[model samples]
Target: MALPTLDDPFYYLANFHTVLDWLGSRYADLLSAEERDFIAAFEALPRASRALLVRMVMRKGVDFRASRLRYAEIGDTRAAAAPLIAAGWVETDAELELAALFTLATKGELAADLAPWLAELGLSRSAGKAAWCAALAAESPAPRALPAWLPSLDDTHYRLTVDALGERFRLMFFGNLRQQWSEFVLADLGIYRFESVSLAASSRAFSRRDELEAYHHLHRCRERFDADEPLADLLAEIPREPFDNPWLERRRGRLLYKFAYRSERQGELRQALALYHDSAAPEARLRRIRVLERLARFDEAWALARCAENAPVSAAETQALGRIVPRLRRKLGLPRGAAAAPAEPERIMLTLPRSGWVEGAVAAHLSRDQAPVIYVENTLINALFGLLCWEAIFAPLPGAFFHPFHSGPADLFDEDFHARRQALFAACLAALERGDYADIVRRRFRDKHGIQSPFVAWGALDERTLALALTCIPARHLRLWFERLLGDIRANRAGMPDLIQFWPDEARYRMIEVKGPGDRLQDNQKRWLAFCAEHAMPVSVCYVSWDEGGDERERQDAQGDEGQPQGAVIEDAGAPPNSAAGGNPA
Candidate 1:
């Protein structure tokens, strides 16, 4: 049935399909023929009529009356559109007689559709938005969109505020404000750079007993600063002699160095170090240690650490640094030493507990008939040497150990990389059998060496190597092998179809994870867990830690029902992830 078309752009109102098409097409860069016809007729509609059509279409999607009770929200459609709705939109709603009297003032025949649609329009923001949009379309050049009114008070305000307040204020206000603000705008505004400048200025002003302003005004360098230039004479008229005086008293030089080190200025740290040698005040000494720590100069930090007897530190300082001792030991390449006990037997090696990928690495060696452990002896020696160096390098600073190295430099500690490393390595191997790569920093990863000795033979018959020999087997034996693990996936896959890879080289598959000394699990171990769980196979986790007294080998296992769990591997049906128990029976 053809309802007479109105002049309003919704002139195509008679065709509901055309109205929906128009709604969808509004988002499109290209409009269909139906939409073109509708727009053409719509352009001829009166302002009020066009507004009504826009509101009607948008309102049909929501509940209006309850919306008024649910959200008496201000600046919204429910309140503004109520006046038109009370004018008898529901036909039977003669309930609002007072509203009827108000609409009676209108000159035209009160349209039945107007009140009902108006109620719908009141139900949603879309309805109100549509009305505003239609009005915008009609009054184009008369008034632009609301975009021209809001103020652009963003970073520029902070910059101006900082300049007026001075250093201390800028540090407190801008640093706090920048940290609290979101990462994007704050970082993009160069807040951190401003912060460093503010802190430097604040340190100077505070030391001079200057009153802090509400904001900080700091000099900003347009380019990177060069420490080689005479800073005091070049930038400010301040005399460097008194300010930087070494044994002459005022702590300005030391304080400035502390500020520079905290701000990560390398040039500043070097300057601070030079003055430290000349005066070595308690504060200067601490700054020297702090700067060295920040630069990851453990040995230097340790050296300064010994002179800290006169240094007063809070109780909290000791507690905080206590956690860093282990990390320090590792960073200095200290040997973690041997595990207390023989680790449990496993086809897999202990990794640094990672989450996603497989654990342990098993590279294959192919020969005529035997792939029997060719890579074992080389791997052992590599570990022994790394451990030896770690033990020698990580130690507390000594009082008289500033003695010269027999190899060359008197102060080998102050020597550069090329000079120190060779000396350091030579010092570590003074007790062990030394030859060729013996005094070298690098541990050999491959054992293709022909000349064998006690050191090479010691790693050859290691207990961990013996365990790998027993537990690991050919990839073809994985199904039977996984039955020993505790996880569920392998057990469930016993009677079901499963995809499997038969690795012939290591004589073991990727799933036959191993555990050995000093190896930690990385993030990839979850796959092993899930793989065993999917196939209902058992999973075995081997641990290699001291077992109090005797140092025992330990293993834990988890298992479940067989033939693929009820809903095993629900994701991609492309042969069900990986099952531990065995190969695809299909």
Candidate 2:
């Protein structure tokens, strides 16, 4: 039975258990050993303060989190949260919702599980979905919690821990990336390439898409991406210029440092000393001191460094090292001067734009009668309008209407194809007539189920329009796009045209391309056009010109010259000064 949920302010205070333990440990030095004392003799904390610490602890602890589907299926909802609401613990935030959902997954019903009942007897009024979705939207991705069942959390377990956090949350959640990232999984998880999605509900930014993009980016490392690892520029998101693939270059220096540092962390002095012997760089040597001082091995770390040919270093640099350095010096030998150091590698994040011109709510036209700038600008415009009109009206409505690339003869009757097509055509015209893309989508489509916003409008369209539109998009613009998507620059690549020269002063690199052509596509071009049609990142196309470029012989000559290069694919540069993609380089 679903109980009426009263808003619970105390619910606003739930947190991970680790946070509380950390805070409690800070006062361990002040507290006297109580092996001989009775618990009754100790003073108790106030309820308010006790609650605060409890909440903090819950937020920080990584143990007890489950990765099973049972946990994910037991999603938090207004009804499921009713128990917390009843207990005055139902404030609306991610911690509270996740906590409540977690309780239901393990303990029992914190609130009525809402999905079944809502599906059976539809919910016309649900502040619950809204509130819970809001909560999920704000959650930063937390460190992966290990199952209590793991023997010991090693690096493999550490990797799985991150995986489990992904499995646990039903709806999207924010990831708090403040903790250091694991190096082993870095390339596979696209940790460096930035991304963001515009949340429909709150104007508030959520880091979920950022994490998802990073994850997808990393997964590309197998097979085709092997050894073609992203450069540090791809990891341009890292502090200091990351050394391309540090694993491939300075792996030993960093790995040894990690081993020595971890040894110090575990208080294994002999092991740490052995690991430091593996270091080759000055940076790695200094890192040994930092770890030792942190572990109160100051005398050894200091002595070890001095007995070598290491060059003299700055006092400021020494003082700026680890906090444990001075503390270790005091404990292991005579203490030296101390200087407060701000947190290094501060919490810096790379946030990609949520929405822009390519994905923006705007309209521009292309031509279909004749392609290549050799044709007049007016010709390009009328042709594009004709191409789309023919595409929208002539193409098979649903099955035949599918984007030619992503799907084949398989799975023809899926409802998504028709629904999306109707929505795309409707949304495009709505924006075209209104001049306000966002307003049109929000007014006509957002609540309607499929098309919602422009972010999804392009891909959500049926296969036919998508495939044809991609084919219609000129080749040159597509080339530049393929380049930007890569983590590394292509070797033996020709210098790309700087179409940055043609874009409007206001639009950096955002306008959608208009591929115009009055003719049918040849075989080689079709292969590429198919890829774009299938992926649908953010683009639309229309045939611009049909009859202005060089002959088939010239095209073949261009492709086959001795120094011309093989496996070459022609693509658009970008929007051009005269026509859309500035008509071929002729």
Candidate 3:
């Protein structure tokens, strides 16, 4: 049977199952041991019970009403939830109630929504706590007395114990815990001190709050990093507290890597190199190599490239070294007699009016010709590459210690590595499989359910478009192409063609880069164009120039050598004057 359309409820249903399958299989490692155990227990239940459990778990808040579970397909809701309730995952009849004083405190915000009810009760309209208390005393339901297991406190509230807090932390750490009850509870407590006076007075009152405090520190560091703080200041002031966990280590490494990255961007190569040495992030190492080259330390860069090429941790790293080595050899004035060249390079380069003009014109032209064209540039390609090497991109490694923010998929380097080559190959193969690519892509982006991936914003393409792309691009070719593209995922992920034209029926696609008036190709764009040319990937650079409209004054200016547009469009023609072989100097 065919898949359902995007608007169909069955589509969401099927996609939900797909997410579950991915969680159960691909992301099993992300869950804690306890979470895995809970999943195992869930699987062991009867089908209806399992469904009900899933519904409960996926539900928004902690205290859902019994009426909310009355879904027709899950049979008797109470019977279905029997196992969960017995397992202490759910509780009933021991409901908590708000104090009269608390109600009086929040009566203003509540009164707006309950205006009709308030008016029906003939309560005072005055905005005073005394009036609110008086009205509540007359009409409010009596607070229930505490059961034997509960504390008999009337004026005070309860707080989560350290163990309970830790449990919640674990859930948040694993992406399962949510800020549901805390959102309302914190908002309701105006200025109350609920914990014991003794605990509050003690120096170790919040000793067990180390994990939470560490996470808070990590967040502060992230903010400072985002604000572009100096590497020296950041190194000195960033959190030194250690959680001794793999996740925290990864997070700390990622933060340090960010500092190094900022240094590199600011042209402080020596300082950046020093910072890179402290990180195990692949991007840092790759940057170090590039910085060495920029500093004209070719021999050092060459040595590092040789070592990385021999033992790459990820496919992206290996691919980067492959490109770097060749370029380094060229930079060192090595001969290229043995390397094959295009017999007759027939790639095209055209002159348009402006950079913006090139994109719109090319996109419109391609769309008019029955081709689905998208201005993906970096977002789509990077996202695809990221997913294909997610494991390597987020793999934890030893680094100079900083604090607790375990690097997740946010960091894409191994010190200088990109992705594990073998795993990348596997991912590409999986991507080519029928239904797998769509499922994986949808699941990753949480399409139609959660946060959608901005990458897949390509127009006129959905799961159908991706399926067609896999058929055309194929796993093997896609693997080879992406491997060559990852010279440095950090750098190569950008400067891609501004437009992509895909012909679904023909199963063909071409990338087009746009250049405006007086604009020239950047180093990265030249490298990408050269790579495409070498591998027979259809790509072009459209140089946009202002149209003169045959005006005499404009014609005079246009006649000048500087004003005249240069470059030829090769349409099944012989090699142009400056072919791809001679074009890219990067």
Candidate 4:
């Protein structure tokens, strides 16, 4: 469908209309009576009225100052709003509480409107708005309309009464509240582009209206939790029973996990344990085990850890269980179980001159004329994999995609993400074994440049880097990394080595994990290192120390280093050997 051009004065209106039509066609069974009536009434309204309502809905707040609602295209705000107000879609008398009043009125207006209240409390007129609001908050005045609060002000407050309804529509369209209406504007302006996926009638975020309501409910709970609401009150409201829908269940589980995590932090172990038990979030089980161990309930933790080990929710959970299970066994005086982790990657010790970023310093120290080192923390491999598996990742599965502007499939991190497209992913991976993987990757990189994917970092994976990676990296290594990624896309997508050095002539590459002073390998990084070691991939951990005497020289070098190639200095103190055969690259 063609988006409305910005040249059109009612572009937003046109976009809103498009959304309404799409929702009506796709979610006809899911819309409530109220939502259906709203759509019909909205479509029947005058163009100006519809535009005015759309403007208010698209804006930041529900309450809008009529005098401030000036648009050249939408002449006479009062006339435009008259029909909306008549239709009960806009309210002239919105009860603004003290905080809402503070938000709506300017500082001068506040001082004038609350002159008597401020004077009664002896608040200085010169005081800041926050100070005035804080002082007036103690008075606890009832909420009042603008006219009631400011008798002399000649302005009507056009509060869009249908904001919640509009948000529901928005939620239906974008599948989440995080994406705003500006997406349409961005798409229209060519600032953002989306792949044209065929959204089948069956492809939608919510299968039923109840699922939509559950999502909305969870969203509000998350908001309340973020707003610092009382945990006990929120816990009481949060549904302990899991939703039949996995998507909604995942969301609920995530929110419960947060609440449990907060409770654990607050030393409420019992509360946290209970919440974690109720949560179906993937991490909740591991957390529950940790909390049990913390509470000295070794038996319970051991039992749960064993169950989780038998049927692991994810690779990450299994990895954590390996650690927790062993410790719990020792605490319980049980026989040692859990297998040994893979050997760590080769270690390289370097004492380089202090420079800007530690990774940059390491890259410069290790890079050679023949072998170029790049600081690709997590981008290179992910980009290569994303390019190779473009088809599998963007496979138009039911519930995977429903909207046009999705950066990636909605179920990218879901448990069944890989299972659903196992065959498609197998076909993609087969190219890696068929000696045609590089060609496929290169083609995808050229064809799908700048189109959003969860894995591809477009800015980082330039042509030069892609070419070097494709030439030097072996297909076997790519397959291993891609397999690990598909194992747990949410967890394994990150924590790659900080830098990669490529030898195009030798068709060899080495991944380097750099550690600065006081920096240590994170858990995810450790997992990645172990994975590389187990797979016999060339990887190393670089321990860097600063040369105290070269501080001044390092500063000087940094300033004049703009045009210099990476690792320009061949003889720096403690620099890695120039030859690839020097063993550890350091």
Most TM-score-accurate candidate: 4
lDDT for position 297 in model 2: 62
Cα lDDT, model 4, residue 500: 93
Clashes of 3: 29
Q: Write one digit per residue (lDDT tens) for candidate 1, span 1-586.
A: 1222344343333333343333333323333354445455555554333343334433322222222222122234333334334432211112222222222222112222134434443533334433533433443323211111112211110001112122222222222112221222233333321111111111121222121121111122101123444444332421234433222223334334433443345466665555554432334555566657767798877655644533434222332233344455566787653333322212222222222222222222111232232333123323344334432332212211211111111121221212335455455554343333232322322331222221233334444343343234322233232222212221221221111123243433222333345655432343334444544443333332222322121111113344432212212122212344322211
* Model 2 spans > 4 angstroms off: 1-256, 279-283, 287-586
Ranked candidates, highest lDDT first: 4, 3, 1, 2
Measured by lDDT, the strongest candidate is: 4
Q: Per-residue lDDT for 13-97 in model 3, tens only?
A: 3433443443455345444576566656655777666666555544443444454467766778778767767766666544344
Local distance difference test scores for all models: 0.32, 0.31, 0.51, 0.86
What is the total number of backbone clashes in candidate 2?
A: 63
Span of ten consecutive residues with least summed lDDT in model 1: 153-162
For residues 1-586, write the lDDT of model 2, one tens digit per residue: 0111114333322222222222233323322233112111111333343333233223433222222211222343233333322333223222323443343232112124434433444443344554543444355424323222122322111111222232212111211222222211231233321112212222111223433333333333222223543332333332222233322223334444555565666677666665665654345566666656555566776675554324433222333343334555567657586564322210111111121331121121121223211111122222222223222322344223111111111112222332435554443444334544323323322233231111223223433333332344433333333322121111101122101112222221212232322334332223223333334322223233322233654466456865432222224333343443233211
Q: lDDT tens digits, residues 303-388, model 4?
A: 88889989998767877877787788789898997487578787777766677798998887677778899989999989998899
The better candidate by lDDT, 2 or 3, is: 3
Candidate 2 RMSD to the real structure: 26.8
- The lowest-lDDT stretch of 10 consecutive residues in candidate 4 is 566-575
